[model samples]
Target: MKKEYKIGLSIIGLLLLVFTFTDMNISNAVYNPESKFGLIFEAIGEFPSAIIATFCTVSLMLTREKDKSIKYNLGTVGYIVLLIFFSLMASMIPVKYLHGPKALIPILMAIYITVSYVIAKKCATTHKEELRRAAIVGILTFIFVIIAFNSIKFLWGRERYRHMIEVGSFAGHSMWFIPQGFASGNEFMSFPSGHSANAAIMAWITLIPTFVTSLKDKKSWFIRFAILWTLLVPVSRIVVGAHFASDVTMGVTITLVIFTLLKNKYINNLEEKDAIHMFI
Candidate 1:
């Protein structure tokens, strides 16, 4: 893994550990009709981007096309194997069921694997471009996630999930523009779902293009499968009640904007200037 990505993951893991402890401390903070913010935070963990980003940053370490392709293939295959294992574990962990799994996630997993295999087969050269595409993508994803987590905490301050207590205002103000929680005396921010943002970021930005970029054609069998896998990540989050559709929209919007900017401004221009890694 690149130094930056390692740092990012380490930080996130540490932060999550902290939150788990804090959550334990505040376990009694739950309320009946949840403030939208509370619900958003709870579900934000299911975002596709969040999962993909975690993988992509590490994969970015590959400098040679061969290495990159190998890592991509390996990571993807590993995920499917793990998913299958978890599928069997469903009896022990309800989350393993994948809210709307009904053959959808499984089918997409198959597609992801098949298309990814085809793309790996298509690479004619093993050139290592000097451009920092991998690192750039990684950094952008890392920054987006950091922002998402912070925003969730700040916005969902009224979260009383564990403690079962809901008290506060959206902006900690009474003004209408201040936007109170979903209801009276409510406190929480629910408009944008962090989970959706997390999942959409990877699906829309990295996973989708990562698959299609190497494909011969979008309409080809490979592309079709790649697209399905990409879309499935975000949809899975919603199916699990981790985020509202609107939250996904916002996440998609952000992911698209950032992706387009990065793809055009940097990734497309990734010629070997022989510069150092870009994610510092």
Candidate 2:
């Protein structure tokens, strides 16, 4: 593992530890469902997943030309399925919850996906092998992070602060460590914030340095941006009473761990001659 990733994980661990104790208190102080900043982020906080899914879809699509064998064809089908599933999952919340004309949601999604495809195609064309490898790591990270966090959310079945407020009862409130199991609806999937997990997946941008040699020097900037986005989105979730601090912390931790492990195994451990840059 890279020293930086180790440091990053350490910091996340410390935050999770602290939040475990202060989660409810922090949420109590910051809970403001009507805050303009919180509302704006509520609609857009999951946008990173759309960008990640689009790039992965583009990269995998470009790979279809390398072989026409049955195995490759099957893989192509799987890739397309994943792309559609993930894209829809990423866009559903924002589109459904947006306060404006519903028609604009599809238009904005089309534009973003189109732009992502173009950029991903250009990058993959220039650095074919590197980008393809990055795409695999990214796709695996996204899949695992989404599945793991959502599964935990369902199994934990903790109610959101906002939901508790609406019910006018703290009876349903549970700590992050408690698992009520089988949440009946969206209101109960609150132990781990899916928004925060999706936000943390933006960390995939940091891996661009491994493929885009020209931007290798700017890797730290990308990492900083990813970290900032990950933290900010969770803060928004907390401000809006959608999640406690522990929920967001655990959500971010899950993504960072999965991404770090996959990246280390697939990208960092590559033979020196296989690429021009190593993802440190």
Candidate 3:
């Protein structure tokens, strides 16, 4: 895993260098905002990320309790599943009915907390630790991904696809070579697509819990789903006027590196400590 991480980081760094040198020429080929293909891909791309987030949340809420009897644990899991089912059903209601898509966030948060608390309070009353860890993992996955993406965006400024000369923006398509202060503010803030990075992070989050679990079949399915989602999210951002192809690619690549490192260092450490306690 470490070797793979090193190799992946190296390849992404090389791509960053190459793209920085040829940003304008590369972006010019596919910067058309009016293309039907681009519009269609952009429209559907966001759905995968949402799906991944839901999967992560559900996985976190349904964690297995090490000390509980199988029969009792199964009952608790069934209850959690019902909670998730209702939450998902609520999500399907029209966003406007919830006030707006953005408004649904707080609603979902309330639902997650309420459901998690109820599950811990009643269903798995004796296994609160497991429930708390699950919630922590899900919430931490989201928080970490957002923090990582925004941190880089604030520091590394690159222009968006539509901000190029070809797209009618006065800001010349300065490649990734230009930092924020060196170029127009609009042109210098687009190196990595925040959307693409977020998607990658969510995909990884779905996989983190699987690392120490014996659920091979479930893990395989999630891996396939994450791979498909990771690919789609980047394509969607690029097809739209939001990000250049390289910008999306690099965003996912860098995010994967960050996610992997953090998971190994922190998540794996916790798992190891838990394993030791089990033996002791």
Candidate 4:
């Protein structure tokens, strides 16, 4: 069993390394908002992600956690991944690279799967109860995110993109048109990359619920993949050129902050008395 586990992890690691070195559509970033944003985010995500991870880890430490060896490792790994991803997303560095989309996204999936699995399995709880709780929490949080995001969408209407890049000033210069995220045609939306927002909201929604269950089981792996499914929609938006590098940035920043806060402040205590009811 131990040998197989080691071998499996080794194989996964090797695959990630291979993908890391593989060429990217690095040139694709020239006008592609998605690729451009992906590059920038891949560069910058780590700083904030690491801060988020450290906060969570510190939470555990402050409480004097015992029997938490695995969760600690999982959070530590998540921290490391954010750091590494930040480096990899830099397209401006100008290294010639060629990579298959298949290769890149799978490595991302691996990270999600790993985090979800460690959290689900290593944390103590009844499997059925834990799954149910995670499901409920995930569902509720996701709904709220979508509603809130859309409401923000409606509330901000045509002016939101201004907040995104401050386009009205020349100052109005804070914008990207190739991705077409501006309210130009729509005139009611702009500011955040809705495509990126959905993707990030999905990621947060997916990750938090697992905290209700700890994301450490084989079944949880499937759930993690489901969350990844959310990424595809955003990638599609970028390909269509409706979002810009800055828009995606703002969108993700919004998602990460909201989701992480909700997860730690509330979802972390799902097993505690009547917390799930709070979702009501």
Highest lDDT scorer: 2
Give the runs in model 4 whose Cα sits over 4 Å from its true position.
1-29, 32-128, 155-188, 204-236, 270-280
Q: What would the per-residue lDDT of candidate 3 be over residues 1-280, giving only the tens digit for each residue? A: 5787688778877877887666566666666667675665455444344444454455455554446688877866764664555455335433433345765755774665465455445533544444445444544555566676666666767667676555677454555545554334644557667667766755553543344344445776777877777877676666556777677877787667666665665556777998999999
Provide the RMSD of all predictions against the true structure, rounded to 1 decimal.
13.0, 3.2, 8.1, 18.5
- Ordered by TM-score, highest first, the candidates read 2, 3, 1, 4
Between 3 and 4, whose lDDT is larger? 3
Tens digit per residue, CA lDDT, model 2, 1-280? 5688789778877887887778778988988888998988788888777678777877878854667799887988887777666666555667776755666656666666677678777887788778888888888888898889989988889999899889999899776787998999999999799999988889999988877989999999998999889989999999999998989889988988898788877887784545556544
- For all candidates in order, the CA lDDT equals 0.42, 0.82, 0.59, 0.43
User: Which residue segments of model 2 deviate by more than 4 Å?
Assistant: 1-10, 89-93, 100-109, 271-280
User: In TM-score terms, which candidate is top?
Assistant: 2
Model 1 has an lDDT value of 0.42
Order of models, best lDDT first: 2, 3, 4, 1
Q: Compared to the true structure, candidate 3 yields what TM-score? A: 0.63
RMSD of 4: 18.5
Residue by residue across 1-280, what tens digits does model 1's lDDT show? 4575477456645644554344323232332234454344334334334334333433333342444577778966764554444333222222343355455655554544444334333421242232235445644754665576446435543322222222332223221113333432222443344444554454333323333454324435644543454355444434433333333445544554565566555554443232344543
Q: Give the TM-score of each candidate.
A: 0.41, 0.88, 0.63, 0.37
The candidate 1 region of ten consecutive residues with least summed lDDT is 168-177
lDDT of 4 by residue, 1-280 (tens): 3575477456645643542333122113433444654554433332222222322332232233346588877766764564344333322122212333544544654554445445545432444344434443343444455456566555444333223333533223222222323244443454455545545644433444444544334556655753564454444443434443444445555565566555555546654546657776
Residue pair clashes in candidate 3: 157-188, 158-188, 158-189, 158-190
lDDT of 1 at 28: 28
